[model samples]
Target: MAPTPCITVDHLTVNYRDVQALRNIRLTVQPGKVVGIFGPNGAGKSTLIKAMLGLMPVVTGRVSYGEGTLARQLDRVAYVPQRSQIDWTFPATVWDVVMMGRVKKTGWFNRFSAVSRRLATEALERVGMLEFRDRPIGALSGGQQQRVFLARALAQQAEIFFFDEPFVGVDQKTEAVLFKIFQELAAAGSIVMVVNHDLGESITHFDQLILLNKELIAAGPRDRVLTRDNMTRAYGGHVGFFGHVA
Candidate 1:
């Protein structure tokens, strides 16, 4: 595999109006791995990703990819915001939502090329949502909806993928599908970051873990980050659900 630029977060801080959310976060995330951001509620796990993507207001810090800032190279990024943030009532078909991924390259109001259609179709097929392509996105089950979004992200063919709470309402099958594709992306040298809350066996799927609680706690290999001390610092109590930790 060729060398690729790792994601660098330096002295990152975020404030929500008058309240500070994250402070002085610093980490380096390499490609070729599925990185999980784990923390208790209001711990700023999602804030970190949003700050890195420039979606949240950052008071200090820089997220760099290679020689340039990540915000400046967004075309190479794929993001799936939390499900609650999405408007489920939106009247868009599964195919329409998947095709939207090509908008950045195909441009708005322009016809999509055959290649774009092929990519979108293949993405849907990979996610097992091809048969539901014509169904309304709002009408699908929670797992089905999540699969469609995954397909949409796949259609974008991005080098960096950020998922916020993807498994919240998904079924076992959806979770399995997600991890399978995430491993594939990492194997292909793409950066895959997921914001997850579960501390069960599912935690073992991540190659690296980022633990936070309004600030950085630990980050590195799963075993290193999920140490008893690290877990206590991040969760403020004994974590009993994650079986893989020491």
Candidate 2:
């Protein structure tokens, strides 16, 4: 059977202390596509994902992954917040971090099953961090740290992936690795939505581009969303140069 219900955001609106963060946003995300959320600073790019995930209270609208509400299906969702939002000071090994992904399946008080361990190990290997499995997460470099987290998400095996800012502080190799994994996930029929702050060549990786500026600007292929008018509307400048990523 075809993918049942497409992901839908219906009139999502978010408020921060009476200030409107997002206003009446609506979009649909199909499975097996890597979607990129792009916008200027303070344009609610991050807020849109949080609101859709039910992490933040939405003043209006709802998000549906299929026939059911998305927030209610938390187990099928995997979210990786920005690196800045994490505290690297916390002491935890790379293995420990990857194993955390299985907690939802294993239960808090229960021991991780052999299947969970295998999944974690495979995830580490996929991200090329298996050799550093015993290293403290805090001691690794920024790119290594991001890889470890990516491994954790891979272990989770979620249908819908939400990455707030996966490439905030990483090297070129790390960027390549992330895009590779993201493409792999999409090829396997997963929903990969990334909030990318940078609006450069990296946008090419996304199959769909969602341009935002406190509201919906454009949502479709890069050629449609990357227009000079849309860029000027989002960035508020002449933006004379706007071309399709391809």
Candidate 3:
């Protein structure tokens, strides 16, 4: 039997008014896999995730989840946007922010019940931010803020997870913690897609790689997809643009 794909994106194209962000992107990811999206700047890495979550306007093609589609199953998906996009100065407690994930399931105008609060606290604990539940979100460091956002996503309890630059400014220890949580999510048969920029670490961390440069460059196991040829192809003569990190 063919493995069930948690996500199937077929010949999808995304446009941002005058700019064509993503072009003819076809991808299928099985459940329980940690897929990494990589390329240099303007590669449409975040655009792809936004398209899948129905946050970006698609000029053409289809994006489906299982046999249905993303639009019909929005509640089953969780999105963690890049930390830089959020307004951290907003008046919100750590617990308040995490509880917001439950808003979709519990509808607006409804207060979070005990069960929702418990789940939110547990997620905070899982990400090592439980101690700061009552603290103001703006008071936390960059890494802590990221973890709070992740805990919020976790509180969503969705089957498919999409994280955009979750490791952007986090420390190695925090990155490891997030990776372990990702592994646990996949182990429980949930798909975890991370939009990442650390090219060197991509080879060692992800189960599968999705290379993009305004088009589908390659999609397969990390070892097969991260070769020098594909690297050069996706990066296009700029493979050595950044110093290699040991």
Candidate 4:
């Protein structure tokens, strides 16, 4: 079999009202790698992914997956937004949330198939949330909530995964579980991209890095993109390497 086609962003640009959020961004996301988007506050890390997925309006350029644009293949993409963006008290059970992932496949106004239910159950079990399936989403801890969302994504069985700030506020155990699953997904030939703000040890988990500061600072393997000069350009100062400050 031939290699899977990579996701490509060509001369992408996005603006928010009068403010430019991202400018002339270009990158290729290959299958079977965990690519991290890193930057300072308001550096457009989230904006870039959203634009690539066509969740946000792009002022210029385009994002293509294989030979097709992302907008045309959204069913193959799974996105988990920041925890802060979700309403915890939405009167939904954990099972309800996870099953939502099947909506695209199940079709509107159609009941989920038995296979879809089985997939959702397996996803919850993988994330260790099966026992709490009937519990309200609001009753879960921060880590539990994140795990539930992850389960939802897994149930989607999407080829491309986009996670925005998945590590923020999650417990250490959740972080470990999440990274393990991410590695598994990459190993299985999926595209995984994470938008992360932490400039600490967790940065080591990514195979590739896309450093941004309202524009493309650098994009490559972690070692090549995490250089001192790139860090200074993206963050406007020196950042600690590994676990030590410069």
Candidate 5:
């Protein structure tokens, strides 16, 4: 079995020019759980992950995975950004996109080995996109495109998975499949973190929640972190709960 990995963010802050995106955020993410990052639009949900991964400039604090800093251990992480961040007209086939996951392992100027090819193939099949392997990415529907990206992340076989708004524009079937895979990854001692804006039934899928409003509002088990007060504070007093708010 693989060793469990954990993420620690200490006094993290992010800024874009003169605007502050995240402020003095702190949290610890344990392994073997599906953690959700939730908040209103522009509440810095995406900014948190990007700052942790060092994709954006940070004004303060640091993110560490296990005993090492995240910047030094990025190869162990797999990140799937929001779908809107991708260019659908990039002129790549579904297979090409998935195989790109292996590029880091395969190295520059090196051809993909048989093992890399097999991993990519298995990832595509797991996401039910093997038949569309040769199809141009632009030809697929929104849900299919999302699945292809999921397959890409799966192919990377990283210990930490960060997904930003994966459920957006996806079909119910795709959503079900994505959550099933996330649960499996967590069960296997991988750290799975998802960024989501919805407060509905889909929120139940997370085992842990990190509620944010440009700062850390609450962080704990789903039920504890989704309290009425935290919801009101994070969503500006407009959140309604039905059936215990999951």
Candidate 6:
């Protein structure tokens, strides 16, 4: 039998007032895998992420972790929100931001101690941002900011990670670096899932793809589920042809 999935969603549904954002969403994400969720704007991609984290209250159904529920296992997961969602002008150093990840592990009594500082440093080093650790977050470029957020997640040392639109405005070099970091995370047995919109080109970097258009259109290995037929179905049959990757 297949290894038990690290995360599972069963018959999940969400709504905003009378507007249905997600309808009967279901998926299982295995450990050490890189999964991509692709869809156009207003396709409920963000709603899925928010609902899983309890950022969006669900109207019906359940979101579970492994066989247990999401509420009990919040510490095992780390979230990296879309770059656009954050306020860059926040007065915090890169190191300070990363150190926030250790808050859960430090518990309620102990303050951030030497061990927490070390872990923060290590997370910055892992993301190649240690040299800029002292810099204020507002001083960094777009790519550097993205790296900092990732380092924050790394510092959490969680088994599962959720990234929303990580490549939205990154330079090509930053995109490449992020991909390398993702591969490393997966190799080390962590689940790395990202929500992206650049489907025609971004599918090459993913091992599995979950297509969404208010519901799960298709999900499986990249080569099997990202074909033209499925693409047409998901994107309304009028997508522009971007040349294939050689």
TM-score of each: 0.96, 0.94, 0.93, 0.96, 0.96, 0.92
**Residue-pair clashes per candidate:** 0, 0, 0, 0, 0, 0
Off by over 4 Å in 4: 1-3, 109-111, 243-245
For every candidate structure, what is the RMSD over all alpha carbons to the true structure, in angstroms? 1.5, 2.1, 2.9, 1.5, 1.6, 2.7
The C-alpha lDDT values of all candidates are: 0.91, 0.87, 0.85, 0.90, 0.89, 0.82
Better of 2 and 5 by lDDT: 5
Checking candidate 5 for backbone clashes, the offending pairs are none
Colliding pairs, model 2 = none
lDDT of 5 by residue, 7-38 (tens): 89999989999889999998999989999999
For TM-score, candidate 2 versus 4, the one ahead is 4
lDDT by residue for model 2 over 17-114, one digit each (tens)?
A: 97899999999988888899988889998888888888889999999987788999878877888888889988899999988888865666642888
Residue pairs with backbone overlap in model 1: none
lDDT of 4 by residue, 51-96 (tens): 9889889999999988889888999888999887899989999999
Cα lDDT tens digits for candidate 1, 150-204: 9989999889999999998889999999999999999999999999999888999
Ranked by TM-score, the better of candidates 3 and 4 is 4
lDDT leader = 1
* Residue 137 lDDT (model 5): 98
> Model 6: clashing residue pairs?
none
Candidate 1 RMSD computed on C-alpha atoms after optimal superposition onto the true structure: 1.5
Q: Indicate the worst ten consecutive residues by lDDT in candidate 1.
A: 237-246
